[model samples]
Target: MSSAQYARIKLGNQDKISFLSNLGTLLAAGIPLLDAVGSLLEDSKGGQKKVMETLRADLMQGKRIYASLSRFPRAFDKITVNLIRAAEEAGTLEVTLKDLRDHLQQEIEFNDKVRFALLYPLIILFVFIGVMLMMLVLVVPKLTTVFYQLGVTLPLSTRILIFASDLLIKKTFYVIGVGGALAFISYFIYSHKKSFVLNILFSLPLISQLVRQIDLARLSRSLYLLLSSGLPITVALELSAQVVMREQTAKMINRSREMVLSGKKLSEGFRTSKKSLPTIMTRLIEAGEKSGSLDKSFQEISNFLSYQVANSLKTITVLVEPVMLVGIGLAVGTMMMAIIGPIYGLVGQVKFR
Candidate 1:
């Protein structure tokens, strides 16, 4: 049977990879494909069950699994379709699904690592802000009332603090309004103008490098999976682009595909592009071309980019922690000085009297 004969099937949820892996195993172990799908459907829950039932119905209609999968673009995606096509062509659907599962697992692990690295810093920043705001808006004002009642001549710093606290308390409504407006504006910009702004921002030095590495990692992994499944280069690039989250990276890949179609070498196309593909990535692409093992080259590039991203995240975490701590310390220390300095000066004056 030609690889294209398999019906299109869309799998959703975090459990999708696991389900596919199990189904592949069952099929490989002499279970009929339909029965295996039925078993999966029976075991499924939530959106997964809905997807399986839809696939099962489509299968009964004599549609290919890949075609059925196309109905749910969100779940299956182009990469999934291309991989299925390649697997079908190579007569290794089960093995391809297993490999896809492993690839997805690695991606999940990498994402979790990034989240773990950021979580502590985020929590610390939140707590620091909360404590500082509490001290400034709530605690300092109550303490300042004591010095005021004693008829003390407050220092410039303490006067500044009192003024700020009074202003914040009196203009609290304006503060809330301004904060809400700024948040709304930020949300609007993020939702509407994100693409252009994000592209510009991601082009900046260290941050741009990190973002580019992440995009390269995802691009290389998707390309590797598609190419390894025996897909054509152009087709694989097209499919891989679909999985790329960054619009800029996707655009670069699409442009590269166009260049390839125009008879330019793939590596040269990417190398000549203004897009931020790393030199190492271009070299790997060239090596893949020379070795006729583009799939392996893509995998190697993915590994390199993944390692770079992990290291970058760790560096960012380490750098941000000390910077945030210093900022919090300075802010808190300044506030404390503002409050205590005036009180100490008042006590010294009374002693002199």
Candidate 2:
């Protein structure tokens, strides 16, 4: 059974890369695959060691490395397994493992760039929310009690804040219950593709751009690796399409793959896929086609796209932090004005009377 057919345990990406790199190095040094697994087990601990030991047992049973690795779906994802399969068939398992390591490293780099870009703004947002919530829950009630005793005529903004504070303080359990239920329902429906939220998110301009770039980079990199490992163009496209998380990009690729099947050029397929694919990408693919160096072309395209994604992430971070900060500032300023401005007006009225 393939690893996908068996129960698999998820391995950390860094750990997976380390193990694969070690295995590749050992294989290059003329060790048998079985001995390589044993060597990996010696240096490994915890879940990684267990995964290697399982592979060693499977290797002892005369299974090909790819087939045995495939059985652990958690340890080896489909892309890794397929690349290994192609490499094994082509007698390039060692080189394939090295390539796989490089592929994963690039992926990690891309993801880290994106994650770091969003992390600062998200943290700021959370801190803003927490501070606001605490003030509403703790400070608002006491100040409101003083206003009530003093017979101060509260403004509409103050009334709204008071109501919100009541909701958070008096109905805390109900608020939690409703929020938790809504979150769970949303996640379930969205994950199952039954939620309009998913469709809406995919259609947003900023999200759409980021998704397309990321998916394109991954698709090109995967195709390059699979093709370099001797996989057919059709299979490479098919497998890589599955790795592209964006529905639109995956659809574009599948359409392009069908075009390739129907004897149409892949570049033309991408250009006309009804998605906003970049002209430069289409031109690169055309160049690859013309030069009869499609794999090399894909590598270049992937590298270029990776650079673009990093730049996009940097741009997004630069733009979003300031915008988010301004919004938070406005929100906090409005809240303070609403709460304290009325009190000032009331004090003026008392002096006049």
Candidate 3:
């Protein structure tokens, strides 16, 4: 099989979640590590089976579980590998596995919610585009013929509509090809220049806040997980930066990490290095530091940011629905009035024999 085909068979996020949960449960039930892996291998298939076999063989050769897992970078990220390494040394593998499983599950749920939140706006845009296409292709052409037959002076709006309809009808293939090319170009730009696109997003008012909060939430959650798994604050911050979506947010986190590395307090580093860092986060971290519970502080921050994100998503959905409906209503209404106006005038000008 090609490398790409081989890659496809690797464990996905859900599969990894299941693996972790099952392994954690078996370990908690007092099963030996080797036996737990062996039992899991019975029902495993494809890449998972291959992984389990390798793990079992490695364990037989006296390799540690984390060492075996570190080999599958595609299946287990750096954060997972490092956490498992900590767990093995700390003798908390079962707890760490369950915690990791829950963390991954939470990430999946949050991502699904984010997708669902944005789904409405995309649906509205596509529906609006479809309405425009229908008007241009079907409705406007018939109206154009009527207006021509009546010999009435067409208003500017109607004339514009007619011109658009004519172009759409006469150069349909060209229009479609251009649209497809534009879409492809747009996708390419977004994929290659994600940071640039994200920068633009961060400049927008409403969306910027939402996007930032989402990234912050993810960063905080990652930090909480890493810290809970016994990673150092600086290391946690570095790994957390890698997981965030916004380049700007990641940069800010990295800056904080650098400051923290220089023997600065985590809260002080965040407050100094990140100008737009929320004051609440700074205060909470400071407090948590004083109490030696920085991980709990991050968990609290994650919860707060998640709440705000949920509210923001709800507000967007509530506002977008009415705005889209009203905008579409006005557009269609104006077009109908323009089409009907000239015909109405022509009917009135007709004289009885």
Model 3 lDDT at residue 105: 91
lDDT of 3 by residue, 199-274 (tens): 9977787788788888989988999999998999888888888887778788888888888888888887778745
The residue ranges of model 3 lying beyond 4 angstroms of the native Cα positions read 1-10, 46-62, 67-74, 351-353
The C-alpha TM-scores of every prediction are: 0.87, 0.92, 0.88
Model 1: per-residue Cα lDDT over 223-274, one tens digit each: 8888888888899888778766568788889989999899888997798764
Q: Provide the lowest-lDDT 10-residue window in model 2.
A: 1-10
Which stretches in model 2 have alpha-carbon errors above 4 Å? 1-5, 194-196
**Full-model lDDT for every candidate:** 0.81, 0.85, 0.87
TM-score of 3: 0.88
Q: Rank the candidates by TM-score, best first.
A: 2, 3, 1
RMSD of candidates 1 onward, in order? 4.8, 2.3, 2.8
Give the Å shift of residue 18 in candidate 2.
1.3
Higher-ranked by TM-score: 2 or 3: 2
